[model samples]
Target chain A: MNYPNKKKSFQKEVNKANLGMTLESDIDATNRYYLDSGIAVIHKKPTPIQVVNVSYPARNKAKITEAYYKTPSTTDYNGVFKGKYIDFDAKETNSTTSFPLKNIHPHQISHLTSVEKQNGIAFFIIHFKPYNEYYILPIHLLMPLWENQYKEKGRKSIPYAYFKDNLHQIHFSYQPRLDYLKVIQTVFNF
Target chain B: MNYPNKKKSFQKEVNKANLGMTLESDIDATNRYYLDSGIAVIHKKPTPIQVVNVSYPARNKAKITEAYYKTPSTTDYNGVFKGKYIDFDAKETNSTTSFPLKNIHPHQISHLTSVEKQNGIAFFIIHFKPYNEYYILPIHLLMPLWENQYKEKGRKSIPYAYFKDNLHQIHFSYQPRLDYLKVIQTVFNF
Candidate 1:
């Protein structure tokens, strides 16, 4: 199994507040577990990068010297589970009251909507950092709130109370770390 | 849509032989056409990269100073098609007589296998550069030959004759340069 170098990148900087086990890491571990256990074939897409320059320091060793992160057009994670396509993104917010809508790119929402239209399960896995809580909100549930935000009286963010009321909270586990698939099974029933 | 900068990278060096219109670029245009026409929502994944260092030259601008390309675990392209998961890789070979088996990575084969297990439509879009011909070979058709490569008496590569006989050649069009999905619909009968 030829893989890339083990060196970490600035991508992990966002999780510095979590000590070590951030929601992203937990989800990564869970996805790995899922892959190993034959439960599902999920994976986080590699971070999109726009390379400006590269140097060939040695033969077969191309090093990118200048690059910039690109906004991904699709969700961070996607895969097939029991003949169903699963697509989602994970976000963590420090606010205890609400999750700011700006965290999600408009492209992601449109991509998820397209996925849902094609009969795939699309969703967001949100982590309320202050409360140490995780919630899987399907795109179907999120659409109305998302549409409402553009209206005159709509809120720009989704309140934590709304998540607590409408979504099933995912709890931590040993093997998979975050048993999101379990929550998904109950929510999606497939 | 705020996209990344318009800087070309070493990634394009591989297609220098084509002068300009490589299979990749054609597929990119085709995918864009599919997106605009509201056809199947498929996309080629960004090149996987492993960043080692990043420097912030300005307040909000991050410049990646050191990075390396990673071997992709899955195929280059995947998305929802006709409410089904679609997965595939596009490869261009200069050879006219045969398509080298080594052109495919083991991880890609494994990933496609898993996709097929989950009932996703997994395939390979091969462009024989010398002949200006394209062929979409399903994962199932490729698997037996892949296994045979390990056997003592088996051939190392698949001859062009095999592809011509077994698969339908994808012709070029103006809107979607490579009409692969049409070939797929005809082949898979979906």
Candidate 2:
């Protein structure tokens, strides 16, 4: 397999986080496990990039040299899970008290809202740094916090305690580092 | 909006063809239109990159000096379309007679196959250069061609006549340049 150099760096960065494991690497391992075991078909969506310069070393092969990241218009991970379309973003924050609302964008919130309107499962797996605790917070709950963050000054985060109380906590295991589907089963009643 | 610089030259080369417009530009315009009109929620996925060199010209944001394009593990564009999960890739060819199979990777073909198995709509929009004709070829049709390409002397192309006869043709309009949803409705009964 021709793994991209960026993926290797991403993996290295994940290793540095060392919160049991990074959110991205965990997602990758979990997806591989699920695909192998025939549990669900889920994958991390690639980041959109605009390539400006490339060096053609060979006739058909071109190596991109200059590119800039484009703001994605949708969620990071999405696929069919148990007959329902699943869409979500996985984020990690080091804040001990609260998770910042800045991690998400207005377009993402809008996208999740539409997903909910369409009856698809839309949520996020938020990892609290240092503690290594992961919570699956539904879009319904996140929208209010996101809006309130802007409405109220100096309030742009969700308390870790709030997540512990309201959201379903996903227990990380060796097999599936995030193991969010277990929480999904209970939350969506699927 | 921070547009990526990496695709500048590529887009320029595409525009130089002078057929009508570029696939990338058309996609961007279509997505913007969709967002503005409140149609289906969709976006092109990003390519994750690792910034190897950076020059901090400003205090807040650092400019990337050197970077490499990452090979995406999944498809390019995906989102909720009329309550169904839609996943696909858009590819263009300068060849008037055939579309090269080499443009697609084995992993992508495998991913699309799995998407189809899960009952999600998976397909590709083939843009025929010079003629400016576009066709949406289902994953089922593409898999065979992909396999045949590998087996038969590594034949790396599918003729335009084959696409004309087998695939659903998509008409481009000013509003939605590659307005594929119309073809999607006719093809998938969605």
Candidate 3:
């Protein structure tokens, strides 16, 4: 959402093959690493899209003529880790003072809350691009901030200090890139 | 994949609103029913696709001009159930005698096996459309059959009697149509 344009320093030219890939790819690479080593079976769900119209240009070639991106029913990333069901989303923001709430949809919050109710480990991997900081913000911390949106006592964004103090810091690594699962191990004792 | 034509009487015109919807919708509806009742948190991953070209016909409108479906990296459906991770695919075969091995891709078997190594529940929901029957086939039974495809001991498709006797039966319901999770209770003991 607003996070991409908020940080000019984080912008970089990406290869054409990864047209729609973003912070999600970094997380995917980490997931792939986890999967290959038999550490976890995690994956990023494909972007849900609704193709309204299509045309057959050739015998086996179909060309999409009309389509629209559909809001997904669940968060982006989900899988199993150490027999625990893990569900989460990864986001990047440039805001130094606070991470905007708009980056997450109301449906996604409710969906994660449902997963939490089922006792699945649910959280968000928030990256402050300006500082190159990544933190595992659990659902427990997200709920209050999200609920505050409907009440008067809540601020519009989560402050950087709140992340620094309450959230688990995820270190950057070369192979796994953002090893948020390592943070999960420390926080959830996996 | 050939199951739909195996039985002719099972064929029926699906409503147009479900343009690309397959037998998987019944599973999705079942998942939604489970989610709404706090019974489980399951979802069918969107079909993966590669968007090649797009045109901005208007200021607020964008149309996809070229796209192709990409093979999914994992199964079509997965989620948390009673705190246990569940991963699977749903198939409808009209065949009364043998279910084709071609319905499932080799990589899916590999993906599910990886999930199984992590102690997650992995299986398939195959509907014998002709008999109007559904069965929850566990990964243990699937692995041998999938592996047999590469060896002399395996047949091309699983026999219908094998499903009727070996796999757990999933009855059709008015509310939770497929109710495959119901069978998960007996097999996984969750």
The candidate, 1 or 3, that scores higher on lDDT is 1
lDDT for position B90 in model 1: 84
Interface RMSD of each: 1.1, 2.6, 1.2
Per-candidate DockQ values are 0.59, 0.32, 0.70
Question: TM-score of B chain for each model?
Answer: 0.89, 0.82, 0.85
Q: Write the per-residue lDDT of candidate 2 for residues B1-190, one digit (tens) a residue.
A: 9654655756776666554347867977887787567677677776666667654454434356576656677788776666677788888888888998877887788777777777788898888877888899889888777878668486679988898887888888989887887789899886
Clashing pairs in 3: B3-B93, B3-B94, B7-B94
What does candidate 3's lDDT look like per residue over B48-128, in tens digits?
879888765554455677788788889988999888999998776767798998988888889989989999999888878
Compose the digit string of candidate 1's lDDT tens values, residues B1-190.
9653334434466556464357878998998888777787888888899999988766557789999999888888888877788889988788879999998899999999988887888899988888889999999999999999999998889999999998989998787799899999988887
Which residue pairs show backbone clashes in model 1? none
Give residue A77's error in model 2 in angstroms: 2.6
Proportion of true inter-chain contacts also present in candidate 2: 0.42
- Cα lDDT of model 1 by residue, A1-190, tens digit: 8653233434455446463357778889998888888788888889899999978776567889999998889998988887778899998888899999888889999999888887888999998988888999999998888888999989989999999888999997788789898899999986
Q: Over the stretch A1-190, how does candidate 2's per-residue lDDT look in tens digits? A: 9745765665665675585346788888998887777677798776566667767654444566666557787877888766568899888887899888888888789888988876788998898977878899999988778878767484788988899888888888889766788889899887
Q: Best by TM-score, which number?
A: 1
Best by DockQ: 3
Worst 10 residues of 1 chain A by lDDT: A3-12
Q: What are the clash counts of all predictions, listed in order? A: 0, 15, 3
Candidate 1, which segments miss by more than 4 Å at Cα? A1-21, B1-21
Q: DockQ of candidate 3?
A: 0.70
* iRMSD of prediction 3: 1.2
